[model samples]
Target chain A: MNKTINPLSRQIFIMAFSLLMVYPVLWWLGASLKSNAEMSSPNIFSKNPVWSNYIDGWFAVPNYSFTHFYLNTFTLIGGVLFTTIISCSLAAFAFARLDFPLRKFWFAILLVTLMLPGQVLTVPQYVLYNWFGWINTYLPFYVPHALGSGAGGSFFIFMLVQFMRGIPKELDDSARMDGCSWFRIYWYIMMPLTKPALVTVGIFCFLWNWDDFFGQLLYINSVDKYTINLALKLFIDTQSAMPWGQMLAMSLLSVVPAVIIFFFAQKHFVEGISAGALKG
Target chain B: MNSDITSSSTTIALSRKPKRWESPLAGYLFLMPWIVGILVLVAYPMVMSFYYSLTNYTILDTPEWVGFQNYSEILFEDDTFRQSLKVTLLFVLFAVPFKLLFALVVAMLLNKEIRGLSFYRTMIYFPSLIGGSIAISILWKNIFGKEGFINQLIGIFGFEGKSWINSPDTALATLILLVVWQFGSSMVIFLAGLKQIPLDLYEAASVDGADWFVKFRKITLPMLSPIILFNLVMQTITAFQMFTQAFIITKGGPINSTYVYVMYLYELGFARFQMGYASALAWILLLIIAIATALVFLSSRQWVFYENEGGK
Candidate 1:
């Protein structure tokens, strides 16, 4: 039933919604370029844009540079992506392919962990980290990702397992017929075929680690060791006047890498999130 | 090549049942990293937290056995605890339904064949990716602050606006707005679910002379119920655990009006160094979420429709 609605009205509706969605981002970009004096002015949009705020905010924090924060965040993301890919892929392969004793029980245990809020374990985890001398180090930041420890990582593993289940058992049977060991079958056959799922998992791990604020705040105390998100918090805290321009400039800069990653990995992001939801 | 293949198969046959730990060892090896990580990081800490919840532990000293004192105090004596609970509940109540509704509406709109669909989807989904960061919280504070962009826009309508981030009445509302703005992720999931719904169902309804509203109610709503449940559970959990926005924008400010439960727990554990009490609060939160989720699952039997069940 092609009920002809007015194209003009629908376009207007789309435009209005788009503008409403885009307005905050535009305002943020504008505010990030405005000086403190201009920020205090009645008209936020009318202010002369000072492009140097980005440079100034870059150097504003003492001893701990934005570059350092960027590096730290990148390392965290890299570490997480690397470890999550390895561990989740391996575990997913085992769960999807191997017949083992009490496999369902173990899978059920993993599922139970997903429901338990991370906050419930924060204090004890902090103490454990402190006890292990992992506090103030990047170990606490990246170790969980490496180990498939969080809900995101475990959920990703579960997702990969489901996708792997869809792969034909004939491939495994053929590989076995060709005298390939189980390990070789998983490594050579399954791993390469599951690249899309891996990419999805990798993008998620990277984005999650990059944007993680609470974990960084809890684990990393020193400014020099701070992730980008933690540095952004520090930037907000130390500004005498609301350094709106510099804050915006830094925030915009901070979001650029994630946005770039998101754009490049958009397909995986969509597929992974949807698959995860559907499976759940 | 045949001799090589024969030798490999013979080798596999030779190694198949050599020992109890031979074949499954590789499987266990593959899963070792995650298993060990869970034991050290997840399981151990969880047990420790449960133990700590029954004690009077501070960061500076060893935990002393207190046996339900912390839980009792939080339930009865602490006013801020009560306030935080009320604020968090209010925030969840206000945010979750609106978020789901907004997600469903946007998903419906985007489900149509449109020009620049990818671009529109990107624009919407980008916020959810960005909103999880501290930068978004900073942006939120600036936008909602007195003499900020929101006020500037309000002035265009000849209305003077108060400092939203600093006012008790408006602080929580601003946080709610922030939550609402990040509806993109859920909307994408909903869109995916919408795609799975066969268009022929809608066509059949239209052939029966069903109105748009009637078709939407009878067809779309029932088909979308499972996705709705998924979104609801996830969004509810997120809403309850909201921290970054409140932390950056108001710091649970203006007479603890926006003081969310998690923020209070953070303050108790980190700021005040009350580890035991904080652990207790965490467990309480876990209980609350689990009960709420269980309740939803129980109610889903009544309302949530699975397509394979033939709408039973």
Candidate 2:
């Protein structure tokens, strides 16, 4: 008798596992449209789905709604994405293309910084931000990236450096011979060449900042300035009447943008992620 | 003839011209932002954390010097610290292997020449990309709660189940389960590694009448050991610093059963305003992670394979 697990069984096992794995998200989708009492019924699907969960959850609180939080989140992610891409691209260019003093030293430090846990610096960073009167504002979030520090800029810088290095040095030499300024070469030549990498960095930055509960939770205090993650937490914290349905609805909504981004940008996202692993 | 060539080459190397200085100023100009960032953000904060670790500083007041007090207390007297350390270690122990196992299995399955592989890959990977989010944590809470889906599904088999996340006994396990579910990133890396393995080796093994298990043990394991080591270190480091999911899902809950080290640090720093003690804890955590990483590196020489190291 053949003891081997047939390919059909293997495929079936995988397909079943896939369903089991995705069950939570699918259940979340179902539960979002559920009412409070109905949530405990053990069925995620409601015979009569409460579409009002979306509407009510949109304006869950009196003073603040999910809209304000979504706007705040987008603004924060946008600033971080913009700042990280520019700063990292510039830095990667310098590291990969330019010959300089202490280049190896600085590069080594950057790599070391990559492994250093950001949580270790949180307390001091908070103190510094508080000193600057930057707390309760988005400045605490994006200012680090503006100065080439935040959103895992070190990793992004390293990735872009690897990419920029792969673009033949002759391109830089030719651009220079064409009277292209170093900045122009970086801007016109390397920047265009590094689009795939930049997109990868952007996707990572977006996902991280979007999912960031700790960083944003620590800094932004004002409800009006609350990001989506912060706002979702507030649903449990400040709400005396715990409307599980509306809260789950809002939480599900918060995930949609991220999932959509991942769905569309899957290729670049995988490329960026796998490139780091494979190449490193 | 070889000795004459070597002598000529050494002379040529000795006679090589001195290195000319490149445009250091230009490089500095480009790197100015990162330099300033390091000085102010990374360097300055690190110095201050060390200082704070030595002092009795809360956020509201100046750090009064109480040198070594916090460290001594943490090492000797802190029950919560001890508990959190045990929990974090146990978490790393439980979660990393299971996660890697799941990732390798799925990656291997995905690596097969199957149709809709990308679709399967996407489904498996989708959770990982956003797994760390508060939204997913909330979803996890609902799914594992008393009336959650797991219990509901189990109930269909005529077995009543208790709340996984709510019980102190099962809370840590629930979080570990959550970690295991987010194995997509590692799975992707393993998939890439699987792709890198030459088919000829497997082909040769099969031609020799070797069974699948024999082929896997002899051909695949050695080839994949380096990737396994990579995933191990990365996952271990991540597991050590895990906060958001623990904080959100269980709040280190029922009896502080799931209270990870970082969660403890967060509570100390933010909730209690014990910034000094928190800084000390952070530093200690850093030391722990560094030591753990070093241990992994030390052991890697025995198990981790490199293609060029054949018979050497």
Candidate 3:
């Protein structure tokens, strides 16, 4: 029920909290553009903006090229998105439609993996990767995505399965009656109908792989092989004594791609994350 | 004429008696990639980790089976392990409730019909998207450092502020604040849940002259129980596995006061090359989380409401 309180006061409260949330980000952007001297000054907001820090930060380190880092991150995110979509969709189809023996058991096992912490697996995974000579290579970063190894892949499979279950079984039966193979029904009908789930999975996989830090740190050893997160870490290490302006500049720059992608895929991201919870 | 007759008869037979394994075989083929991947990447590693937990293996050396010695040592002889457990439990205990409450309140506010609702929602969710990033962690370190922005702000209020990141007393607390600030993801989920709730329930309560607080307690909280449980379980898991912030911001320093279990496991596995011991720690963490989750599920019958159950 609507309260007896003044609508004006409610509006004011909302506006104030909104500003509280937005101000830090705006301040971060402002600080990032200011000169080093200005950043250390008493007045944080009054500083004169200097955009050169972004340029200089980009070119600061040798062999730590921001371009290479971007390419590596792009490859990682792309591989994750592609592999997650293909593998999870196929598996989700199996769980959602094609009834086979012991299906419930296998699905339960898959759900169990979702609860296991990444740290519990990290040690053994490191040893295994080293044994396979996969360390210091992109294989460590991308292979899991391709293989549906991490939580993202499992969550995607679960999400897609939930959405797929909502599709009418009569469509599959009709296709079967028309002499269409199971594969044909899945590829032609089910896949197209589940585009929303695919988009949701794709956006999440992109954001997750792009922001992954621990995985990158463990796998990529050389400076030249650094992803954006690793590069940012190295930047911090070398410029520990530098002004906050340059560091904040680089940090803000590092987050721009994620923010941009989030805005572009905002609808799908929210739907994907909340759908399972809502259904449950 | 004879060949055409034979082909027609074969087609009739094929339609009459389909291959028993055909459909399932196709399904298996479709599932092959994920199945193989899970076997090699997930299942194999899990089994191997169980094996490693029983051994005294370093990364460079072959493992020697030692039965339950590693588990016993960790359980009985390790002080650092106990301390890590304490720190982690403290974190989950303090952070989860406050995060859930803050998220719920903000979500309720946003659920109201307001101008620019999407913008407000977007603004709130920004922190969670950037929450675990190294850049944000670094920003936190700077903001909480001595002579940093937070202290400078405190100075205006005539309050002396300590070096939050460096001080053992405040390091973990600062991280908790950081986590609470990033309640955006849970907030979004809560908002979605709030939208699903029928307005008629509140209307009915108001018809009976129920007050706001009474309606909220009787209706809103109960209806939202499932979503609350979802948030609680997920947040609890994430909190236990917390690594990035403690690693980058505090470095688990100032006498290991901020040394979270996962961070210590990382040091053992990668930095110190103590794979066997790290695997033991990992298993312990898994056990802790599993037990905690089990406890939640066990208690859920008391608080969590399922609408379908009333029909049954």
Best by lDDT: 2
Please provide, for model 2 over B1-312, each residue's C-alpha lDDT reduced to its tens digit, 9 standing for 90 to 100: 999999999888877955454657778878999999999999999999999999999899899999999999999999999999999999999999999999998998888877778888888987897888888888888889888888888998999899999888999999999999999999998988999999999889878888888888888888988889889988998899999989989999879999999999999999999999999999999999999999999998887778886822
Query: What TM-score would chain B of candidate 3 score versus the native chain B?
Result: 0.92
lDDT by residue (B1-312, candidate 1, tens digit) is 999999999989888954453247766777778888889888899899999999999876899999999999999999998999999999999999998899898888878878878888888876889887888888888888887888878788999988989988888998998988889999999999999999999889888888778877898899999999998998888788988788888899999999999999999999898999999999999989888888888999988998887877
Docking class of 1: acceptable
> Sorted by DockQ, highest first, which candidate order results?
2, 3, 1
- Tens-digit per-residue lDDT, B214-284, candidate 3: 88888899899999999999999999988889888998887888899988888888898878888888888
Task: TM-score each candidate.
Answer: 0.94, 0.95, 0.93
If the candidates were sorted by their lDDT against the true structure, best first, what order would they fall in?
2, 1, 3
* Residue-wise C-alpha lDDT for candidate 3, range A1-280, written one tens digit per residue: 5464466777788789878876667767776777755654445664456777788878776655688888878887777778778888989999898866567787897787766677767877788789999998888766777767664777888889899999999999899989998878888999999998888888888777776788988989988777888988888888757667777877888888989989998898788769868874
Which residue pairs come into collision in candidate 2? none
- On TM-score, the candidate that comes out on top is 2
* Interface RMSD list for the candidates: 2.4, 2.0, 2.0
TM-score of 2: 0.95
As for candidate 1, its clashing pairs are none
